[model samples]
Target: MKFKNRRNECVTTSDGREIWASRSVTVVVCIVLVCEDQPYILVNQRGTGVPDCQGLWNLPCGYLDYDETTTEAAMREVWEECGVNSLELLQGADCEFFSAPWDISSTPHDARQNVTIHHGLHAHVDRLPAVSNAHNEPNETADIRWLPLAQADTLEFAFNHRARIAKYLSHLERVAWIRY
Candidate 1:
């Protein structure tokens, strides 16, 4: 089914089912490393040239590229924004844990022209890379920092990343409880 018209802005199939057009898909990767017996997550501040959220902190994330899988896109974003190579550091991350699509159409500060399908995943690392720099996408990312999970929860994040981080934190709590 297609959009009814430019003016109508809604579509209906012959069976009267509403159709939704997904504008784009974005992959968000939360890289976690354990240091000093505490878990820290990688975060980046948006640089000046970013379309929005300049100077605001967010998880390593970006739009899914045309010819890349979700995992590939996530890896690329992590490298570009956090200077970490997931392929080398990830300690058997279960990518499927956070593969579900989240419809962020109604979220505040979200784009209204297109629906955003947010896919998130957590990459647990045993150690941090010596140089975690945002060199590839210099304009899109400003500073890279690793914050303790508890401290990260207190900071405001851009692009609804706080929700994604909360989900990861909840999962961590569940896993810890299960292990106990």
Candidate 2:
């Protein structure tokens, strides 16, 4: 029953067994849009000072705020990192927040030497936003682009983002099959 708190201090129980604290909880948002009859995912290049992923591509993501839900955090990350207000321009008839069908672990290793809980979210939009509309925050996002979902594997992604994209693709395939 003993566990480590946010400060990494152990909360002792009678048994005194230690449980690791989850220091990082993040929501990764995959914003999909149809361009020229193809699906593209919004991605960003990590800016300088971004721990392990600096200069590498990644899905728009950020640590969850204490007052936000995972879904809310996902939308916020998209807007902050990609400058696209997904919730307002949302137009997918099948639009919903879905995770991979497989048992993907929520807990993953962080470069900062902390336990991380990652929540993957997918949202399909009817149109693409102007690339110029996006803004960059210092030391967080360097560049933004709409990468083809099929080509996601071709790029080097920070952390487990590649796997997260694969999970989204899997969900799309499942949905396609379910339509029949």
Candidate 3:
């Protein structure tokens, strides 16, 4: 059988198992900021009207727009969510792929098979600055704050962000000596 996927790519498969290719792919970016000699991560609290994880904190993230590169999407999300335009990507922050098959909850509400490509970066800032929700979609974000790495571990996070944060924290610990 042959058909066109959501992105309008033609696909041909002999068997029925390949139907999953029709699902949409979303690129998400998260920034882990270390400021004032302490590691911190910027997270946003989901507002009540959000489809999932309302009132829960998670890293600044958003879907990749059409015709946009992952890096472009990452920078755009940071600016829109935190109002920070000056950001430097972490040296080795490559794309990490996560799919709904691994964790169904990561899938978007409308997708049958969703893949999220997450890119984590390090923000350059001396201190945490005030963030505004003015540019955020209605009820998309309730609040934004920079949480200490240790403190963040103790709080409940949306999706697999807790694990993702832990991984970043571990990376920071391993490279601390060199950075000092």
Candidate 4:
């Protein structure tokens, strides 16, 4: 997993202390899947000049605002992080209570003392109509790439994006098989 400079990046101390470039902040990230005939995920690159991972590949994600529901936060994250405006959060991942390796300059209430990372899974209802794809608008993201799970696993993402993606894929695979 590589990292890049972006405003939404998380900040942390060398010894793994959680900190944010901004004070009192909430970060919300969503692993968006365009589940059509096949399953593909949305990823974006954080541009330069952010507290955390300024230049690295990551799943569609960002920090939550002051007053936003987790579900709404997930949807907004997809849009701001990558540009997928329309999305629906299917299920939530509880593997980790709190999101860890805290990106950005903001820290959780007890982030400095505790290290846990959590995020939600949002799947798009509408098909792309085109190939699984995205755009990298300069400024925030230099580029965007939609990779199939198989090929996606081969990618090097920043922080725990890869792990999170893998976890979501495993869950999806299980649900898919159970349905059949």
Residue 68 shift from truth in candidate 1, angstroms: 0.8
TM per candidate comes to: 0.69, 0.72, 0.66, 0.56
Compared with the true structure, the alpha-carbon lDDT of candidate 1 equals 0.65
lDDT per residue for candidate 1 within 1-180, as digits (tens), equals: 985434434677899998764555667776666655676778888888788889889988888787887677777888888787767664465442334433244332334333344444344455656546636555877778888777876776897788777766666556543110
Write down the lDDT of every candidate, Cα atoms only: 0.65, 0.65, 0.61, 0.52
Give the top-scoring candidate (TM-score).
Answer: 2
- Which order, best to worst by lDDT? 1, 2, 3, 4
Descending-TM-score candidate ranking = 2, 1, 3, 4
How many Å off is the CA of 32 in candidate 1? 1.9
For candidate 3, the per-residue lDDT at 180 reads: 15
lDDT (0-100) at residue 75 of candidate 3? Answer: 64
Off by over 4 Å in 2: 1-22, 98-104, 108-126, 132-135, 176-180
lDDT of 2 by residue, 26-54 (tens): 66776666656677788988888566668
Candidate 3: tens digits of C-alpha lDDT, residues 63-170: 767797766766677667666552434432332212111121244454235556565555545666667777777888888877776688676788668886666555
Q: Which pairs of residues have clashing backbones in candidate 1?
A: none
- Stretches off by above 4 angstroms in model 4 are 1-36, 88-138, 174-180
Clashing pairs in 3: none
